[model samples]
Target: MQRVTKERCLEIISRFEPTKEGREKGHLGIDGFTAYLLSEECDIFDEEHKEVCQDMTQSFTHYFISTSHNTYLLEDQLKGPSSVDGYISALKKGCRCLELDCWDGPNDEPIIYHGHTLTSKISFQAVIEAINEHAFSKSEYVLYITNQNLIFLLLNIEE
Candidate 1:
């Protein structure tokens, strides 16, 4: 990590009038300002502020998450094609949660595609495999999969 010098820190604080005055008055410097920003009085994280400096032990609901819907559809919902590339794309762009709409295919295997429409289908296993390969490439958090499936046995799909 690059260290912020006092000059650089002062320059940054100067953009805001209140902080600039505090720095000019010599009441706030790099170390003091950094400590003040992290202090409980700042209320940066609210009730969960302690978790900011420590490993997170809070429930997942306590945090905001980036999510995407119909993550397999690359284009129009009704007429476009579905592909694992869409999932890979969303995951690469920092989507921590994805929605996969699964439907029964003509073959024994389950496929992913938007249902009740004319969308093209992609192999469900292919999407899962793509997700497995790319889920953690951009993020350290657990990827949440919201599987919406029709009431049918999803067969011949491997992990």
Candidate 2:
């Protein structure tokens, strides 16, 4: 780090100095002024002189969340492959929210893919399992899952 010499401090304060008429009679000289400016009164590193925030509480609206759309698509929206890897990747990268486009699949199972397009489909169950396994690998914050679908499929499974 560069050292702050008396000459440098004088040079810096000279620009802000008042005109001859504005200066008070027997006012402080350059050396005295520089010394005063560099004293404890002007030292930002003085811990006891710093301002502290007494109220640490913050409203939920004050926070910004990180989210992603079409989180199951690994590449381009149209031709990408829908896989649980996408969800895992997003979660590991600190995405607090993920979007899954769901649709009906074979045997009445739900699958995720880009609807009305050529994107490959992935098992919704696999995506959910992946999320459960890796959701907290990178961060301890809550993760929200939002599905985009015309119909919600209901199923019963014993853990």
The clash numbers for all candidates, in the given order, read 0, 0
| Model 1 lDDT, residue 71, Cα | 82
Tell me the tens digit of each residue's lDDT in model 1 across 1-159: 179687765654554335545767645566666665765655445585423354457877887878899887878988998788888999897788888787788768888888899999889899889988888777667778877642222222337
78-140 per-residue lDDT for model 2 (tens digits): 887777888889988877778878899999999999999999999989988988788777765
Q: Highest TM-score: which candidate?
A: 1
Sequence-dependent TM-score of model 2: 0.56
Model 1: lDDT to the true structure: 0.73
Return the lDDT, model 2, position 55. 39
**The best candidate in terms of lDDT:** 1
Q: Which 10 consecutive positions of candidate 1 have the poorest summed lDDT?
A: 149-158
> What CA RMSD would you report for each candidate?
10.9, 15.6
Candidate 2 Cα outliers beyond 4 Å, as residue runs: 1-59, 149-159
Model 1: how far residue 60 lies from native, Å: 0.6
Residue 145, model 2, lDDT: 68
